[model samples]
Target: MQRHSARPLAALATIGTLVLTGCGTESANAGAEAASSTGAGRTIHAQKFMRLTQVHDETGMTLLEGPTFGKDGGLFVVDVTAPEGEPKVMRVNVGKKTLRAVHTDGRGTYTSAQFSPYDGRLYLSDFSHGEIVSLAPGGGDKRTFFSGEVDGAQMNPDDIAFDEAGNLYVSDTRGLSENEAHGRVVRISRDGTKATVLAKDLAAPNGISFDLNDRGLWFSELTEDRISYLRLDGEGKVTSRHTAIRVDGGIAQTDSIAVDADGNLYQGLHGRPAMAVYDRHGERLATVELPSRTEGLESATNVAITPGGTKAYMTVSGPDGGYLYTFDALAEGIRQSNGG
Candidate 1:
């Protein structure tokens, strides 16, 4: 009886193995070949780059949006939502790989935060609070710096950057339901007293960075798959506008941007799960691969570079509690252009 039972089990296992092999073949056949670059009416296969290597995975659950460096060289990230449970600013000691809650505003969804070198204050844009709030220089008391309806308008202020003269720039981006093209870039004065529109009709402008020369501004439009530039006066006013780099045959959703010491612009291509480095002249130098394929593109929102300018840092969004990734720049084949 025992031999009879063992023989039947062995036969059943063999049948299951055959079924699995058939399924594997079918799955492989379902995927078409990846598109190839065309050359003189011929197809040239393009190799996919290596996926992003992990840097620091979060132990907690805070949804990190913008990761900026503090004056003390600490990495500060704006937690749009508190980790698994608590509500607060997600502060990471990169040197130690430890996480802490710096501040809890009760109002959640604080998307992007930056430290102002001019006054040593922390300027943050609250996506949920619907205002721009700042911390006392060196991280003390927190208060609303700019709030109460943008240009008497309602919108989501997602990211912000500052100019040399101590002026504040905020990305007042609108939601999907609204179709009035209310997205805008607003400049706030040093005193936090005056705010004015520098450019309008921007489609989901998410990240803003100053060029190396401090003569112009580069910002990303999430809905448009295009990086753009605006000429600015010493006082931070728009003189001209033009598209800098268009993501060819891909979505233009970008969340954060950072520049290396040499002035190359590195942008986080959110939903595409890639990082695109552009020469100062707006040409794409490389596209670094990311780990996950499901990120919303708008979620991998911020990029930061170490002072040494060798390694770059980026954050992933949501349920993943976001991750900090370090990138090694492959600068050999990349050309240095102008405009940074």
Candidate 2:
């Protein structure tokens, strides 16, 4: 692993279930099945915007998650070094479109990493270690925040996010069996004092995010091929659950998601070559064409959006190399309410 300054850090499917069940699948209808509307959202098509930037994962077995922006304006990413490769965190300057090593702790195989608006630190998920680790910027301060041994079953930490009040949430795609790999979302405190399971029994939970107002928690079930939502409580506990998007096809599990300022949701598809955009009302807004076939583009896993709602970033796990790609975002538009 490439160590840097102050380095410390860090789906299931059937036919429908089989396709979208786990991470990747060998489905004949994968492409066609992913090209339509799901859930309550209206399906819309998007024009090619901009191919802003592309990054190459120089080392590591797989670039698992991220492109998560930092307060200092750079992005944090994790490389899951498989089969005895030391995991690493890389910093990318979005403005300069350059990459640099931030931390190299040989910290097992890490799947994803995210910046917490509350703590100003980075939370990283180690899939092999089954734990969520925290790393100080530039690899300064580091420690394990939460371990992923839920109900005595091993967990594959996939994604993490935070709510308005700074509460941390993580997705654990446990595995296959009903109780075995059903998947669940866990919540951690800003101070790392409390760790709680917010929701359980989800099928291969992957990317997670909160609504614009932070009133609800949204998660993706890769195996079930559905995006689910849960109503949060005063104490940050998830109360009610519902489906946001349920695709009817081979398999269309989502890997990552981003939300616009206008309350729209954008999801990155794992197998197919595109991203799904949803309006606030759970209406399918747009399906943007991603660079899917060019090697790793087919496994476009994670996504991040600028706070200003202008541009979006996606990680392309290409064959020869993994890359970070940028796209122009259409913040939000209002068609004239003709008959209102």
Candidate 3:
């Protein structure tokens, strides 16, 4: 693994002013209006209703991915600074607007962190170690939950989500380039003993989230710029599959996804200034344009909504540095797990 010198933390400052365009109403009101109106092709300027503020400035480190909320309302994030150096996991107090380190051991390359609704523990995906590690609610006592290959394939877990029954769905992003269909989604049993592939032949499957109704699983194919929905039976097996939405033209890469209580989907765009919003039936409801100078250069890597769905936190990665941004989301976010 290669190592690089760590850079100093940059002075904190407010990112940018909220500018709502194309629509007269504020984002919250516009979102409400867009949600109700049956008319298609209507655009809601999310900046009008939502206030974008910089919570933390990870100037020197690479905020690999995350913004998963714990039961206590604290948001968790990971820092993949150097391949040889230990990765750090930080927790953000959403209400207090403060950041603190939770776990920072030079163990493995950690990509994602999730709080299990059933177990009330935090689960992390160790990409370098090819294993899933668990931590106590307060980030203590790390232990291996699942490791080794699944069905003879090396584990390269990226994003993770849990169902109502405590089962885990992981996106195994095989490689960097999308030249081949090597990505797949794997499911680990509740007890963390058994693992199985739920879907395959995917081109860079990056994010996975359960539907608001709990009847389907939604995931994004980053390289392909497509989002898919999978219907599962009682046993959590994929029974049906279909492309939920596809992005074409400018800003075509799709990253992380989050669902709201109203069955609305919020997707992070790779090379666009806005995040795309979709209704339950796969209808494009709004395109939330964010304020940033690196609109085309940066990518909105991940998004997490609070349990109440009042606010949304998104991470943006670019040459300037990594930044965490928060804004008001009128709709309440749906609980990804059974626990609150």
Candidate 4:
């Protein structure tokens, strides 16, 4: 079970706004009442807040990751296929709700896809190959941007983020066993020349995002069941560290995380059938349960919200395969590194 620290005022304020914009007061209040009675804080049924729909599906696609929005509002995702099929970077046609492969020749397991705000190119993390590759905007000109070992350990980069100056931050989840916590957070220079380790000894750091205020870097430790904040100096050196949220009952299996414009954090709870929402202070705001457990929607691995915050796109994986899901959201998402 997951436990949240007390910060009721911020949570209530967020709930109040949700009650006003998400639905009429009555329905939202009813959902809140039901969730509060269960001692799970203020909550709203996901369906009541937004409609959940499947935008795309394929048989050989064994996993799905990264539904990040490009500068032009187009969504990019990765399809991690079987051994016989190569992984693909796909672009989501938001209007038609369809997908088109952007990079069909990608090698290894593509775990995360991000569009650079400064250069307008797509960057992907190849977990199996231990490298970060770059692709042209329309999926052409694929090249290896960063690779090789970090601190004597191979790079098993899991997720990627960029700061305002175009410097890239990667979370390297590089442990073979459950007790071996050898994860690391590294920063690559804007020119892609120099690599520096900002922190080490992380227990499977998976999800990473910049705070809306640009004050610190936020990341999740999956095995440790905690989300933490790190303040970096002008040269990308770690100055301080703080635990934002930690699961008291053991592993929460947290994966990808996203931040909205108003400083709310939306995190994918891997083993649970829901997404956890937290305030800037790391207080629990609510949990939005995905619909239809029969569809293998329980394993949420990544989440991305649109710029206007009208809808949220999530990547879920299970024994059967992977899926891309979209639903209505309560607030606008933070798109840029500086929270513009």
Candidate 5:
């Protein structure tokens, strides 16, 4: 890990969950509105917007992630550990600070969500079930969108991205292998009649986003501790790929990511309530941190920004509980910021 400061840091997320860490406090600022200054950057802190979930009275843990916004400006989020029968896909009334589950037949482990540009329906990546499911904007009409046995094996779909044509791009994490190069980026045609593995044999492809003009995609491989950009051809096939950003090993894994109008990437870190910003060309911009690393609020797993604006929100969870934080984005928000 490249530490700009020599100061020691501390905790959230533990040894026994999807996040694999523990947290306790609830204060942290993640991103800020883009500044015109070209001098040394300052730390950006996040403000706690709401307490999304309480600590599991029994498990002492909760994982809050997958923050995405709908067309109507409704904020949607998911709980990775919410039991089978509970409402896992929830919509947060940002104005009222209340939450309601839109998708509630609940039987799958939904990790990430994004609304399809073509149909305006919300699409979620069911990690445990190895499927991609879609539901109506109001949470009705749940439908199994994709269930392909790619390479003759079930996919562990982690994050999702949709192109202008509505084709789905998914990150198949390969079931948590540290060094195994079995991960893949799968592309499911918009018609739901075909599935193609765009890229394979990856370390662990997690967060993903489409590039401007639908030319390609940028994604993070948590196991390798780096982010790469995959340039796609006219048909959304990878024609060339290159690493954009590479960071030293850190205890915290890279979770979901977002992109801004300028193409800057806001990469969320799993173990802390913070975010790392990188320019479109891969220059490290800044690290948005909590003003005070309050206990139990360290899991800044995923983030979402308002379309075409700088307003943003981050989803967090830990030993203390789950929360949503708001902050200014580094640049004007784009569609990529509201997706998986």
Candidate 6:
């Protein structure tokens, strides 16, 4: 009787093992892949280059954005929260690590600082006033280039980029979260004569970049947590569009973007203290983390690679203050990376 019971128990154990092994192979493989992909990137720590915490308004917060190199090789940045009469557009000296205000004014929350390659003048996106403004190389002759409504709606211009033809592109992000479907990608002719709507009803398109060889236009959608690629025609009209990359930020949101000479993308995060690196094929390569990630440096917002070099700088802000961090890039920087 004892031998009979033992034999039956052993057979039952074998049956249970077979059932588990025969369970959905696809499900098992997916689980294994997800497990291996957790924390799936190389870790690269960055060094803090500049401290920007001391400069803030009554809100006691400072956001350093738009780390792009000017024609003079200095990095131009903007402070979106600086009060009127304060330095809203500033430049960074890489060697000396110094800051200088190039432009300032009221009712204009300049979020991006970019120098036009054609005219050799500086352009800024006024997020507060929904206007695209320009400044001379010496910060003089400030002018509003784009203002008021477009297609019977107010324009909430966020980030600005220039194409190879000197045509300007603007991301009008005003209605993603509210589902008002008012986001648009507007293009201004190189001659500044016509303003055409390239794409509209986007999901809060924020950071935009033009690819070399006119391959495609890369733009980040904040609400959907993804980067979109638009193939435009010679007239700045979209021929085809596709999703370049999708991000799983959890609490974080995608901000500005920069592209390298090899077409790799550096995406900034709003709540996370790290930048995600992706290859041209949308495969993630690494995550650039701040040395002070847990020490109050949480907002890693944008990155700019040194033109013709791999040196990269990121704009960061947190409860402690705003900061500039530096690291080595995965590839050489392209012209779009300059003030992207």
Clash counts for the predictions, in order:
6, 22, 5, 0, 17, 1
Worst 10 residues of 4 by lDDT: 1-10
The candidate 2 region of ten consecutive residues with least summed lDDT is: 6-15
TM-score-wise, the better of 2 and 3 is 3
In angstroms, the error of model 6 at 46 is: 1.1
lDDT of 6 at 233: 80
**Tens digit of lDDT per residue, candidate 4, span 138-231?**
7879888888887787777878888877788888877723446788888888777888888888887888888886667888887777888889
What are the runs in model 1 whose C-alpha is more than 4 Å off?
1-62, 83-87, 249-252, 291-299, 330-340
* lDDT over C-alpha atoms for residue 239 of model 4: 94
Instruction: Estimate the Cα RMSD of every predicted model relative to the unseen true structure.
Output: 14.3, 9.7, 8.5, 10.2, 5.6, 16.8
- The best candidate in terms of TM-score: 5
| lDDT for each residue of candidate 1 in 54-142, tens digit (9 for 90 to 100) | 11222222345666777576667655544224534656677777776666644545667777657778878766456778876445588
What does candidate 2's lDDT look like per residue over 1-340, in tens digits?
3211111111211111211111222221123223333343333332222232232233322444565777677766765542222336777777776777777664345667776666767777766567778788666588888764556666666777777567778787765434354678888788766677778777778778777677887788776767888899788876798887765425445666666667677776766546677776667766655433344444556666665545566665534345655555546311100000
For residue 175, give model 5's deviation from the true position in Å. Answer: 4.5
What local lDDT score does residue 93 receive in model 3, on the 0 to 100 scale? 82
3 or 5, greater by TM-score: 5
Clashes of 5: 17
Model 3, 1-340: lDDT tens digits are 1111211111000000100000122343334334435433445443322222221233223443667888787877765442232336777786776777677665556667788778888888876566888888878799888998888877667778888778888987765433568888999997999999999889878778898877888998877889999899889988999998876526347777778778788877755535677787877876665543333225556667778766777665444445565555547866752111
CA lDDT, every model vs. true structure: 0.57, 0.59, 0.64, 0.65, 0.74, 0.71
| Best candidate, lDDT | 5
Candidate 6, poorest ten consecutive residues by summed lDDT = 23-32
Local accuracy of candidate 6 as per-residue lDDT tens digits, 1-340: 0111121111211222222232001110111112135644676667767775443544345667877787788888877666666777888889887888787765676678777778878888876566778888868799877777777777677778898767788877777436556788888776666777888878878788887666678888777789889998877789998888998778777777888888888888766878887887888877777643247655677888998988888888765667787778877888788545
How does model 4 score by TM-score? 0.81
Name the candidate, 4 or 5, with the larger lDDT value. Answer: 5
Residue-wise C-alpha lDDT for candidate 5, range 187-265, written one tens digit per residue: 9998777899888888778889986567889888877778888999989888999888885426666767788888878
For model 4, the superposed segments whose C-alpha errors exceed 4 Å read 1-39, 47-61, 82-87, 248-252, 292-295, 336-340
Ranking by lDDT: 5, 6, 4, 3, 2, 1
Candidate 4: the clashing residue pairs are none
